[model samples]
Target: MSILPLLIIVPFTFIILALFIHHVRIKNALSLILGLTNFALAFYILKIVHNAGMLKTQMGSWPAPYGITLVADRFSAFMIFISAIVFLAVTLYSIQSIDKERLKNNYFLFTYGILMGVNGSFIAGDIFNLYVWFEVMLMSSFILISFGGEKAQLEGSIKYLILNLISSFFFVAGIGILYGKMGSLNLADLALKFSRIGDFPSLFEPSLILLLVGFAIKGALFPFFFWLPASYHTPPPAVSALFAGLLTKVGIYSLIRIYTLFLHHYDYFWNPIILWMGILSMVIGVITATSQFDFRKILSFHIISQVGYVIIGLAFYTISGLAAAIFFLGHNMLSKTNAFLVAGWVHRERNTLSLKDLGDMFNKHTLWGILFFISAFSLAGLPPLSGFAGKYLIIKAGIESNQIIVAMVALFVGLFTLFSMTKIWIEVFWKNTKNEKNDSEQRIKSNGLPYRYMITASIILALSIIVMGVWAKPIAEFCETAATDLLNNQKYINFVLG
Candidate 1:
């Protein structure tokens, strides 16, 4: 529990250190070292959670309902650990990929700032603190997104800012109402209170709904996901991959956290809505992605499509379903980040990601193309990959639950996902282009970032996808354990309050 605070403080300390470092190499070195350290700490926390149950610490030595609380359950620890892995990979890649001008401009600080908020959100034990952490993440992201001050970046940042502001507004308003009625902001305390309260008021439903909208926007669910496609591709790939890996997942984490803890008893009220949201996000996100020619844009939309699958698990409100959701969420984070990193490499080398203008990745950069193939096919749910395992679990659970429509949608979504992947594969990797320059000549003419660092970063994540796929039983077991914990709110409440 004491270690939980250090998760935030570690990155925060690096942010302070980064402020004083002007040299790009030193900043990059510091960032990479700290990122690895953060991952180690999170791994330690995960082991602790797996061995023990949930761990809780009260800030300022105040107990439970009166103090700021940080709690780590299996789910949160898993998320923090995965977040660390991506942070380290991105940091290493950014050393070479991020512009030197941006590196000198406290880029590492802003990056660390975002990590702090993400870690904070995962461990926060209450809604109000979660809201605070969301703001921290949003503020850092705003700066990072607009750092280059490119016209496209600024424009994208505006859409991101406006939607997030609305989200924050809804979030705070809901928090206000939650505290007003419950007289407490502690998660376990609220769970106990709501459980014991028996009947809920008419207004209580709206408060929860408001919180849902706020998280929906942050998580990029349909009808609220337009901001994502508009803005995500505008940033540098490192920033885009970080955002892809952690930002929306945090929102999804909150959704799972809130629903499993405080909102489970009210399932009748929210389950229908959850199903519709999941279905629409899956269908709309994938179909829209097919129309996009830009590499990053397609991946950004796929984020929405994949998020829908997780939501469907929640909609089932079963342990098996939630386990699948958690597993799928983890898989998607790695796959999506790697995909964007591949796009980054392409955009760097080919000077474009427009499908019509790009080709011959296999001919020129066979290794990088192979990396993309692993990530893309895994994302498309090919056999014996991480995506396949996750989808198999979800569809099986959906079928057993008699959610035939949900199961069918999951299957169809996978097919379209494959189609989307094939489109990118054919256009970017296989198709031959006219008037193509030789590799050496291309390198001579290009002002692109060097390939070694980026390839190393992508390979680290790519290997993870393969390892998780081949050695999936243990991971699946862990997800099942985490899912059980989430469903058993009494256990969570007892651990936090005791």
Candidate 2:
């Protein structure tokens, strides 16, 4: 009867139904209804959290150590809410964007499957369950990435699949080791048990390292990020938007959860590695972004770079730092999804995503041009946008933690991100094309704003970015509470297992 289990069950139920239903209209209608309902439930969960602080439901009538548990703390609630909103928007946009003949019913099934994985990951109360959810999400994502079965998509998906599978192995191995040592996969039980154990430093450290590395691979951090750019741009824009918005954030959420709840004792060992990785990823990601001629590729690289800022904040391991990271995670998800939506619109109009082949869009598509600019500026951390608010908070926290180098890296990375954005703006919007012959003017003329709904959705998200920036205080307070809950751990355990 608990809603927590429904978050996973409902989407999967629809996925099964969609697989058998061949009618496209029914498929789209059902998918949209399900996505919206799920989003509403996520919002309702947020309301419950606001009133009660945390919500938990045991899978059966059994107690903590004996039964599976689902939890909705402030952090989990925020992530679930964001994932639901993005899933709904993407589902609505997919109605016009997806190719009926190529993907058909399979697209909806995979999409819903991905939602199930994402939502389950947020609420899972045990490490083994978390791994199961992560695999479900990743496998669904692989299918989504190669949905249309294009050559490029197939190639990219292979690379992505290989890397993620490797990461999954590491994750499974780490869980096995942990279970062997602790005899419990429940996060609360593990935390309590680890606290009681005194001289088992070596065993705990290796297990923590293995688990974190697996999360890092999933997160697309530094060395494990090559797969992201290889495959992210190959998918359809709607699929790409969902992947960009939610997938990496899942990895980040897992890393944050494990670090705060189960691996706090190993901060000295992990923090330094995370700090350097953040700096290296920021520099490398921006540089690669600058070199990219394709719009989606640039945005993909920027995703890596922006993630570095979040990692840097969390690596500092202070209350303010963790709070800043959470705020940035929310901001980045909204802004990144908007950016991909813009890319999709541009592709729909021009039939191409290459910056070199696109030109003079700003003068013709003024509304979309403005929306793109807003999203890009937000991603670059420009003032009066949510991105800036997040960057400011993280930088402030870094400085307060006496990590001056990290603060400076964040600032420089922001400027470089701006440079990358400007490059896209000038190439695609400002510059005049010598050959407009290849441009799909006839389609644009006939359709007359083909991606209108998608554009509207993007604008709403962009507005949220601005609003969150202007009213930072309330969001900051929420993030602070979430961070404290993560650090304290008892609230999550009590709510889930009590």
Candidate 3:
């Protein structure tokens, strides 16, 4: 009955209906319709949450702490709205980008499953339920990653599956320990329990460490992120885009949520470790991205680097800090996913992912070249674009927190990020334009496919980036409000327990 549950239900309903309808076109259309429906529903929910404060529903009319609870505040509603938009855009792009045989194998169904999982993660009220949504996401990603049966795809999927299963083990083990210690799965109740305990700090450390290890793995943070670059480059572009945009973010969101809600007023332990982690992830990710020639691999590394930007904001542990992080999170998804989509288009036109093998984009398709530039420059934190706005806010926050070294590291990384984007721009778009003989890109095996939908999707995303960058003040205000909600621990505690 609640809007929170419908976020998960919308995609799930379509996936089930897909089983009965045998027509591929009809099924794919339903996928779009599902995305659109969820997108609209997400706005309604957002408006309600914005107007009504946080909304909570206990399953089966049950009381808090005992029932499975679903809650949506500004942060959760914002995530659901943005995710639905990204999914819809990707689905539109996939109409032309995806392989036919893969589509026949119910790719849309798997896509919907992922949609349900991600939406579920945004609103789940308990740690265990969050883990359940993760399993749902993992299974769908496994199938999508391994689809088409390519040797590389299978290899990537295996490593991904293995690492994530191990992460799941740690997650469940930690959850078991937390429940054993507190006898509560409800996050609000768990927080209340922590308040009453004398040795809360000691109990919190082991359990939280275990949980963060799993989150770090899921979020692809340094030292635990090797699985991502190995696997992400192997999937179809659409799958890769969706994964790049949404999957790891759930982990990041969990970290933010748990720390703000359950681990309130604890700063002595988490701050330094997170600060160093962000610095390391940013430095390592940018340096690696600069060295890469594979298009998607480059973007994949950037995902790691950009996550560092978000983490840097979280590390600051202030209102402005969290707001900057939230803005960066939204900005990165648009820019990063658009970059992946561009790579897919390049592969479609020239059938290559290697930058050395791919060339003369400016002459062959000036339009796509321009679009790629917008996305690339945006990722590089160029002015009047999403990345610049996000990076600026993050650095500003870091400086305000008096973490001058951290801010300096972030700024340095942004320059290198620009260098990597420039490498792609010159290699893929400008290098071959000089040699007209090599400028002739091979046409698709079939030219019957129209470029309209693909271009339309890119345009929509590009415009969003531009608009968000220019109107960043409004977004920053909203993110600040969400941060306020998270920091106002007593308010959330009272609401949940009531």
Candidate 4:
């Protein structure tokens, strides 16, 4: 009766169907249908979790630490629901945004593959399975990143592959060491075991550190984040949007899940490390982003900066802090992806993402200009948008937790973010360009492409950002419940083990 499996099943089914369907129209139609179906299913699953608190299913008649388990508490259910929304929006955009050759090459196939991996990771009940899902994501993403086989795509995919593979090695190695020490892979069972250890487990901390390094790299945290900016812009805008929305977030989710289950025991050792990494990631990411002119690259670096906000929130380790982290994560997913979606439109119109080459976009496409404004300012933490609410919650939590320095840093990062976003707005949308190559003919040629799909997709996500902002109170309260559930680790352990 558990709907958890359906999240994985629906995407896997789409992948299979995509294999047989050679027609591009059929594939796009199927992808949209499957995306809608999955979104509805995710919404229902979240509703059930809200009513029932938690849901779990054991596979193949096995039980507890011996089985393939899927579990969803409020946090995971909420992630699944948000991911479904982003995935659906991207699918709609890709219908018009992706080129025909890439469509022929099974772009949607790999995209659905990512959806499967993301859904699986959210519900994975064991560390080993979590790693497996990560690999699933990496493989599909590797192919997508290089699908066009452009020189830049090839180069970017190489860096992405090498760095993520290293992440995999560290993660699987940590899993091995943990299993050797603890004798179980199931998360709840592992939590039960870790909680029973009386003294601070020095031996276990190394394994946890190894795991953290892996996650930090995967999540594009400070010093481990070079791969994201180097590569995220090389892909088509739709692909970049997908990666921005869901992939790094899985790594962040893993960090939160593991910290709740195991790492929190040694707060003394981990808190400062997490806290400072967040501080550096915030300052460094925003500063670097300000130097970028490429549209997607700027947004890519902001991904790092925004993730740091979530990290600092987690470091605070209070119910408010975790809730803010969760809220921010969801808000960033929508806003960041929508920014990239608008960038796709920019590319389609101008054939380049260089801000210097893009100007007077507001004059040509007024609605897209508005769309970019909504998403960009929201990301800058401006008022009456989801990003503002998210950042407000995080800073308030930081102050309430007496982390004044970190709160101030977060506030200033928002200012830098606003500056960079304004730069993009001014250079790309407001200022008129002097480039003669982009004449009226060129604009008409690019504008001739079917735009309803792209416009509809951008509107969907833009509306989501507005709704989350206007209705911030109820959403933040739900996030608080989810955070409380996360902090209360015993609830998770008991549900899975029982």
Candidate 5:
């Protein structure tokens, strides 16, 4: 009856129903219906939270310490709402993009499974449940990434699987250690026990480190990010776009959750490490992106770099800093999704993502060129766009925190991001090539625009980026409120388990 259970149940039910449907259209329709219903429920919950502050639902009549608890605070509800919007957009885009024979019903099942996992993660109150949700999400992602069984897809999926499994092992080990020390898997219970124990500092430090490392691997932070670029470029563009937009952010969401809740006292130990890694990730990702010729490869690398900005904000540990991080998280999701969608369109048109092979596309498809330009400029943090607003807030936070060096690094990284975007722009949009000679010579070429559905979905995301930038005040306020809830663990635990 509660919205929390529906978040997981609807998707799970649809996935099971998909197994019995023989008609592709019926399956697709069913999936879309489920996605829309889930999206609606997420908004309904958001409205309830907005009016009533927070919402919690315990499974059955059992209390928190004995039964599963689902909690939707301002922060979790906000993530679920955004994630629902993204699922709707991606599902709509996939209607025309995916091949029936290659992906079929299994695609929808995996997609829905992922949605369930993401929703579960957003609401889960137990550490063990969080781990379960993470594995569910990861398994679905593995299947989705390797859907068509292409050589590239298989290779990427394999690498991703192995790395993630290793990360999962570490995660489980950390959870086991925490349970051994505290005798409870419930997050709030552990926090209480941790605060009361006299020798908590010594025992807590290693467990926290292991937990942070596990999350860092998932988030694709520096030294653990090689799998991201290697695997992300192999999937179909829509899948790539969805993964780029949502997956890493889940890791980020977990990091924010862990640090602010159980490990608040460990801030001094981890913040500097996060700060340095953020800087290194930004510099390295941009540099690697500039060196790549494949459009998707470049975009994949940029995902790593942009995540750096989010980490930097959290590292500052100020209200403005966390708020800026949240703003950037939303902004980056929109911009990156649009970028990958545009890249997919370009690849569809030219049948190649190589910059050397595709050129002067702007001359033929002006609309796509313009759209790509807007998205790219926004991604580069141009003024009056969503990206700029986030960057400004993060930089301002850095200044306020007296982290002058990190602020300078962030500014420099923004310039490099611009340079990488320009590189892609000149190569794909403006460069003249002999290969285009015959195509250009034709007097009348039919538009043959890449899938209209995809374009429409991408345009919606681009518009959101612009709108979020133009009217940032309310969103900023929301981020601040969410950050306050996140940092104040007592509020979160009481809301979930009371």
Candidate 6:
């Protein structure tokens, strides 16, 4: 039996246990244990993939292209590992940050369901199976988004649900059309079939377009991104962090997986469309974020801009481009989540996320302030942080691929990002608004929540950002290898189809 399945199994096991347990502390402990176990399992799987190149298993012992196949190559393994880190961090943070009412209502169960879906999506070897995993993720996320049942949460959940359901419709419709034409849902088999159909490639273009729209909407690119900022700010910061860290990235991961497997064959059509989407998303996302007054709203909008970096890297279609995209994706997950975790702390202490009301946070808690500084600056692409390395590689890849204009746009976005981050820093940390409550009163308000858990979680992610930046070379090298594995689609096809 391969250990790869344990990633899914462990979370499912916990989900079942959560249903029978009425004790909140026990549930929290179980969730943490599940998180730690899954993290270990994901790390072990990554090591296995590193040593073995790829790992595969067929449910019920059915052979390739017939059975439900789960395969982990370099790229999938890397994503799973990073997602595990974010999940564990969020799980630990949720102990204190999530309200007890939500906790009693099976928050951990829904969260574990999300983990199962995310892990399953990464390892799924066929297109239809991928869709199933997507539904699983969305179902869990929808529940989490609406868990509070507050008016704002209900409004946000409605928007979130309708948009994602539309995305799923697009995705499944594409899958149906594709299977009708190709007579296969296995990704490897479809790739093989498509490789042989070079003459009438236009026949499948409609299906591809549908799929692209689905992925783009889910990834929150360009015009399809409005749903993100509208809903993300409405969730608890912990829930928002989980969604920010994992949900959108899965959509991007699927896009990259399909692109390498077959979509690249239509690069002539996709190149310009993808390039401009990236550019517009960068400009529009930052431009909108600059006007936001809420802490999470600004971060939510920046998620769009950061995702643009990844998409543009894909547009370059070079090894360096893909490597940078991969690295940037990982960096954004950690930094963005950490930023949200810090926001959780702010919300906990001040009971509001309005920047106008926030001031002297640094004086109140210098360590939390520093944590926010590290994450915010990292997102702004500051030196010696992961964002700098990611942006540098993306720009370098763009220039190397003769897309100088795109590279320049990326540089400018970094500056705009810096501006937004600085605004947050000065407003939230440096300025001393007259509305400041007495320190003792603020402490008493926050004292009910176990602030230590929130701080610990933020520190964990903050350190990961710093470490990723300081160790950029080795991680970047690993991403290069993952990128190579992705670009060399025949290797993936061979492993899965054999």
TM-score of each: 0.98, 0.96, 0.97, 0.99, 0.95, 0.98
Model 5, range 36-113, lDDT digits (tens) per residue? 898899999888887677888888867987787888888788888888877877887777677777446468888888
lDDT of 4 by residue, 1-498 (tens): 667888888899889999999999999999999889999999999999998999999977699899989999999999999999999999999999998989888889999999999999999999999999999999999999999889999999999999999999999999999899899999999999989995663744768888999999999999799899999999899999999999999999999999988899888778889999888999999999999998998999999999999999999999999999999999999999999999998998889999888898898789999999999999999989999999999999999999998999999999999999999999999998786565687777965675999999999999999999999999999999999999999999999999
Q: Name the lDDT of candidate 5.
A: 0.84
lDDT of 5 at 112: 88
- Candidate 4, clashing residue pairs? none
Q: Write candidate 3's Cα lDDT for 1-498 as tens digits.
A: 676888887788888898998877987788889878988989899899888889998878889899888888888888887787788889888877888888877888888989999988899888899999999998998999998989999999999999999998888898998899889998888877776774554734777788888888999887788999999999889899999989989888888888787665466778777777878988999999999999999999999999888888988999999989988989988888899999988887767889988776787678888889988999999989988989999999988989998999999999999999999988888875445444333444435566787888887788888998899888889989998888777677788879
Clashes of each: 0, 0, 0, 0, 0, 0
lDDT of 2 by residue, 1-498 (tens): 767888888898898888788888889899889988898889999888876788887777678866777888888899998888788878887887788774464688888889999999999888898999998998899888877789999999999999999989888999998889899988888877877885465844667778888988889899889889998999899999999999999999999998888677667667888888878888899989999999999999998998888899889989899999999999999889988988998888788999988888888788888888988999998889889899999999999999998899899999999999999899889999886655556445636646766776777777878888899889888999888888888767666656
Most accurate candidate by lDDT: 4
| Global Cα RMSD, each model | 1.4, 1.7, 1.6, 1.1, 2.0, 1.2
Q: Which stretch of 10 consecutive residues in model 5 shows the poorest summed lDDT?
A: 441-450
Weakest 10 consecutive residues of candidate 1 by summed lDDT:
442-451
Report the C-alpha displacement of residue 419, candidate 3, in angstroms: 0.4
Per-residue CA lDDT of model 1 for 1-498, tens digit only, reads 478899888988888888888888888889988988998999999999999968888888898888988999999998888888888888888887888898888888888989999999999997899999999999999999998899999999999999989999998898898888899999899999999987786634777888999999999997788899999999898899999999999999999999898777778878888889999999999999999999999999999999999999999999999999999999989999999999988888877889998887787678999999999999999878899999999998899889998899999999999999999999999998886455557767554545788889999999999987988899999999999999988999988888
Stretches > 4 Å off in candidate 6: 201-204, 436-440, 447-450
Per-residue error for 129 in candidate 3, Å, reads: 0.6
